[model samples]
Target: MLLKKSLNIVMFLFILHFIIPTTTGYTHSTLEKTHPVDREKVTESPSTIELWFEDPVVLHADSITLLANNGSKIELNQTNVDAGDKTHIITSIPEELPSGKYKVNINVIALDGFVIQEKIGFEVIKEKATQKKEEKLKIVKYSPDDGEIVTGSPQKLNLWFNQPAEITAIGLFDNLQQPIFLSEPMVNTEDPNHIIVEIGEELSKGTYQVTWYAHPVGADINEPDILDVFYFAVDEFTPIQQLNKGEPTNPFWFKSAGLKQLGYWVVFIGISLLFGGTFLVSIIARQSDSKKWFRITSILLLVVIIGEAIILILQKQELENLSLRQFLSVKFVWIPILQIVLITFGLIYSKIRLFFFGVTLLLIPFITGHASYPRYGGYLTILVSALHLFAASIWIGGLFGLITLPKKEEMKEWLNDVIPKYSRWALISTTVLIATGIFMTYSYIPSFSTGSFVKSEWGKAILIKSVLTLMVIILGYLQRKTIKRLTSKAFSTIIRRSRVEMIYGLLILLFASLLVVSTPSAAEQGVYPISKQDQDRELNVNFSPLYPGLNVLTMEFGTKDIEKVEVTLSMPPNYNVTYNAFKVKDNVFKITGNLLHAAGTMAMQVKVIETNGEAEVFDYRIVIPGEMRLNE
Candidate 1:
């Protein structure tokens, strides 16, 4: 049954890899903000344009272009960045122009040379015209969108604006301004914002324009009426017909995914054996063979820890863009350092030192892990996560020690005292492990639920770990049952079962290691949250990793379609940064930025503009956290 459980886990993982082998790779650093802003409306022509990106910019390889809707180009001429800040890019907009919309194209590179292209649109409208037509009332729909090429003759066209406005006249015309016949336009009394125009008959294939004049509600009557024009063309073919068809898909198996799985297994067994074997040796001094067994366990544990750390370090370096020097110097290096220290003291001096080194050895995974990161809980969760690691190590590591217990002629005499004491300690460690695991899970994944848990990689890992844990517990129960009815013939059978139980325990550790590498859904949701007093509207906002550095901000609206969002973080005395949040999914906007440079409280103001033109501002006192580390 224990072997069956391990086989089940392996099968599940095999199917998951073939079906869903983690499509999400490292996303390139995003361009955070622009001076005029993407799709912004400005009052007057600006002399300069600026851009802010999340990562350091590669200036020598970057380019920017400004183009008019009529195919004319506006020369930006020169580009520059602030000497002190590589994230800020600047350029000059030389000539001011008539009311029109322009597109700014940029090709940018990160320090590591990852390149991305973006096109931004900003409209230049006269101050008076802008006031008469509120920005939210701007046209959002069309008879056909601006650049669409339709195939079939269209008998009717529809347009929907963001809000209701007073309508005046409607005109239909060909490309040459030649008039076309159309029935009187219809506007639904219940939904006046949507306008529909019915063509009397289908016309020949050509370009056509729909023009209308209207005044927005709640505007001054003396203000000039607004004019809007939209165009669509009937072309030879639809784009869907021109698509390059491909054959059916095949299964994908990544070499990297396979290697990651391998790392997970090694680290799991390494921690368990290194700590468990130490605890086992401290209890047993009955036979001469016990000392030889302890020495063997020590050597094997040392090899596993060193090999595991190297594998994980290589994995991190390959997946990230950090320099080789930076990668080598990261917190992961502490693992091998601590391992060497523990082995030196524990082995040469005496076996008694193994007990101290054994407990401290578990700290390697705890120190560099995201679960115990300082931002989550000051010093509390870190301590709890460390305790959790230690408890699990004692429980599973001891199982490995049980496997090495004298299995031949000397086994019957040794098993009498060693089995019962180890069992009691294993029970105690198991209880602590479960309790701490639950506490830490609540601390980090507060949004935990069956639905949310299934959505995240972290949640999936936890689920698998729980399953393997159940298998180990069941095997422990059977081991106790075998011990209770032990006979002369059953000694070898009991040893075989205990060894299988050790394998099951190692499998639990495997899932736990995978969990360490995955990002929790809670963390992925956002970063440091703004203060409660700052919220003018009752919207739930949560940000992940509320530290002094880069973070992702997440906002959830109950039933509102957030039309626009503007966030400003004020690192008082000198720095003030603004960001435009973009929608990632349903009712959620994710904005990534560096909120501050030091540990202290900062002020953040979020202004949300809803689709109905309603706006609200929320003020928050952000507690900027510093990276907390465990003492060496």
Candidate 2:
């Protein structure tokens, strides 16, 4: 009878999974390559715009259009697919484009009839100085010189230009294209020609590349800019190659990274079911026949083993070219293997000591999680996280056990007996879960500002998990209230609510898996904005990064009849430049330039000219954030 009831429950869940719709699995052909790649700066404008796709695409006369930063469309010749490679599409520019920012808009139809529309932004920089060849700037020397491998992560990067120059912009990227933390550049006071920047944190073992732009101290506006690039490695060196940008069809699930996340979710659910089922069978439902429950949970343990194996394989794939011995030595590699070994043993010794065995298994994941690597209170954090996971297993696993209970005539008596016992355990588990969860949140997120917390992927995952947890809590409360009065009508309702609670409980685990893969410091750059109104006209300006580097200034006006907008920036101790704000859309203007060369209060003068001949000038003062670690 127990076997038949458990089989029925499994069949019900199987049917429910299919009843709900799954996302489309049809993969769309993506853009694989681009000429003058996105955001690349070229010394000379190319005669053609080339785009290569993963599959052939059908192009129309208006399939490709080039637009300047000011929103003016540039003329282009006919679009054609390369006969040599059907996947390659090319279009020509009729005339040379002036030095400015431009975007290539593609609206081609892929072979699968999916419309692929995207914009690739790039910049054209033509040197205008007629100075002699000897006067051209050059890099005299630099530490961690190109192709040099250091013993460990370098603390600082130094550059010596032939002449004194100020760094306008700098970027340091690892082989995986992830940016490393860097402080704002500083010119050595004693030696004006030398510049240095602090590497905020020690980098992991990987090859790195640095690109920087500098302007000669006394050079005119038209003088050619100085650009230098170099590559180095820490501990080891490897050839660099671009990574693919393929993504999954559904954006909401895993943000283009689905395979590993799917594995993690499966492992989490499997652990919860096995742990919770063991607890219920041993402690709460001992009088009932538990052989069928043990068999069902044993199968879940196998599933858990498979999930861990898959995760291990994926981790190996991420760190390529590792020998089996070297791979086994990594903590990330061995932890899953250890779990698999312990679970296999548990499956073998099931009827004797599986409940106590699960207690040991529940503590393994925290060894590689956030708690193990916190900045402060290391061991305490690991303990808190372990308790949190243990508590979650009790609540979530108990919920699963409740939903699978047979609906026979003795069900009411069974509920009366088991509900009170499980309720006490769940109540205590809830307290532990909430307390540890609060501590984990406070430890993981470094800042609560809009840029650091709200805009980060880690924060988003926490919020989604919190919402699912809240829903489960409400369902648990409903169950607690229903237990006081177990009417016949309320019996079916309670069962339905328990099943829904289990579903939400599983979703919380899914988000927990997401949080595991996310980086706490992956936050968006800051944006500062100001809004003002004079008479009937309103003006809003937004400045991004708020640091001394390449900055974008965006503005919005009250009316759409504006003819032109001009902005002049003035900073004391010698800095003044004017830039024209181009119309990006209706009543919105934007400009991108290397402004705010130094950290100080900057004065901005905005002059707006309307089509009706009315003119208005506004003055505003803004403070730029001091030297900061970009990654922070």
Give per-residue CA lDDT, model 2, range 328-391, as digits (tens). 7655566677776776666667665555447545655543344554242457877777788778
lDDT of 1 by residue, 592-622 (tens): 4343445444567878888989987877755
Clashing pairs in 2: none
Clashes of each: 8, 0
Which stretches of candidate 1 lie above 4 Å from their native place?
A: 1-261, 284-291, 298-302, 309-328, 366-368, 407-409, 485-490, 522-530, 534-632
After TM-score superposition, what is the CA distance of residue 400 in candidate 2 from its true location, in Å?
1.3
* Least accurate 10 contiguous residues by lDDT in model 1: 623-632
The number of the candidate with the highest TM-score is 1
TM-score of 2: 0.48
- Give model 2 RMSD, 1 decimal: 22.6
